[model samples]
Target: MKFTRKAQAKWKGSGKEGTGHLSTASNVLKETPYSFHTRFEDKQGTNPEELIGAAYAGCFAMQLSFLLNEDGFTANSLNVNADVTFEDGSITQIVLDLEGDVPNIDCEKFQQIARKAKEVCPISKLLNTNIQLKISLNN
Candidate 1:
């Protein structure tokens, strides 16, 4: 199976003063405000690294939910927070914080399943950056 998304960006002027527009083939559009002061700030709109973190977190959570269900333990809720760090124009780390409420599953089992899900999730497999995982279980 294969999937693809097409996006384009157009920038004007130098990195500090340049601003850019991003648009997907599906016509979703966004803007990037570049300035010397905000080398790390989100001046406006979404950036690539932020998007990657969002995608990875969402995907991993869903996969973990499915794994829980498959193990006969339905989750009450699953919340995932992903942090992506960039340095030297490359991704340095991706940290995943996962919190879940499972009615009948023990902590050990839940942790085991979560670890397996993290290992097998599509986004985890795709990323080359160091992935750190933290899991919390609630009764």
Candidate 2:
């Protein structure tokens, strides 16, 4: 029940003027471009915070789905969104927005499960930031 994934980053030049590319063993990203422009200047590419948000969203969604199934409800659709807040050169907060359509589930129970998921998700535990959750149930 243990696994490891690898991604590599290569950079040339200094911080402000430097350019870099990231590649992963899964090949989901292949020499993807990332730099100061991409991270701060609203340019075309990816950044570490953006990637972390993506990973958190995906993990939360999957974890929520598992919990719903365990609760005897089958989710028709689940959407999870993570907003990562950066302040004072540090990641300050992570906000999770979750919406789900599950059969035979009450809003109260769904929200309860979502709260549990937010508390137990691996990334939520890994990041030492304030985790805020907003859950919406669609039948």
Candidate 3:
């Protein structure tokens, strides 16, 4: 299966002084703000890196849940957060922090599933940045 989203950005002026609006072909992002200041602070709308982090985090969590269910365990809750760092005009790193509560699953098994999710999540597969995963499991 394959899926794709089309988004466009329009910027004017320079890096520090310029500002831009991002829009999606499907209208998911309608004139969203993307600027250096937005990346640093007041992210009222969205930015490219933040969107990447969100996509990674959400995809990882969903993949983990599926793995848990396949192992005859159900997740009470799953929370995944990804931090994507940008440096030297490229994506430097992506750090994933995940917490999961799975009923009847031991820590070792949970860790294994989390590792699998990190390895197989679509966003992780698509990214070229250095990636790190930190997972915590609770009864």
Runs in model 3 with CA error above 4 Å?
A: 40-45
After superposition, the stretches of candidate 2 with alpha carbons farther than 4 Å from their true spots are none
**What lDDT, from 0 to 1, does candidate 2 have?**
0.90
Could you give candidate 1's per-residue lDDT for residues 12-121 as a string of tens digits? 77877666666778774545433433346756566677778988999999999999989898888999999999899889999999999999889899999999999999
Ranking by TM-score: 2, 3, 1
Worst 10-residue lDDT window for candidate 1 reads: 30-39
Candidates in order, TM-scores: namely: 0.83, 0.96, 0.88
Candidate order, lDDT descending: 2, 3, 1
Model 3 Cα lDDT, one tens digit per residue, 1-139? 8887788999999997789999889897889888878876765667788899988998999998898889998899999988899888898999999988888888999999889988998888999889999988877
| Clash count, one per candidate | 0, 0, 0
Candidate 1 ranges beyond 4 A from true positions: 25-39
Tell how far residue 45 is off in model 2, in angstroms: 0.2
Q: In candidate 2, what are the lDDT values of residues 51-79, reduced to their tens digit? A: 99999999888888888888898899998
What TM-score does model 2 achieve against the real structure?
A: 0.96
Return the number of clashes found in candidate 1: 0
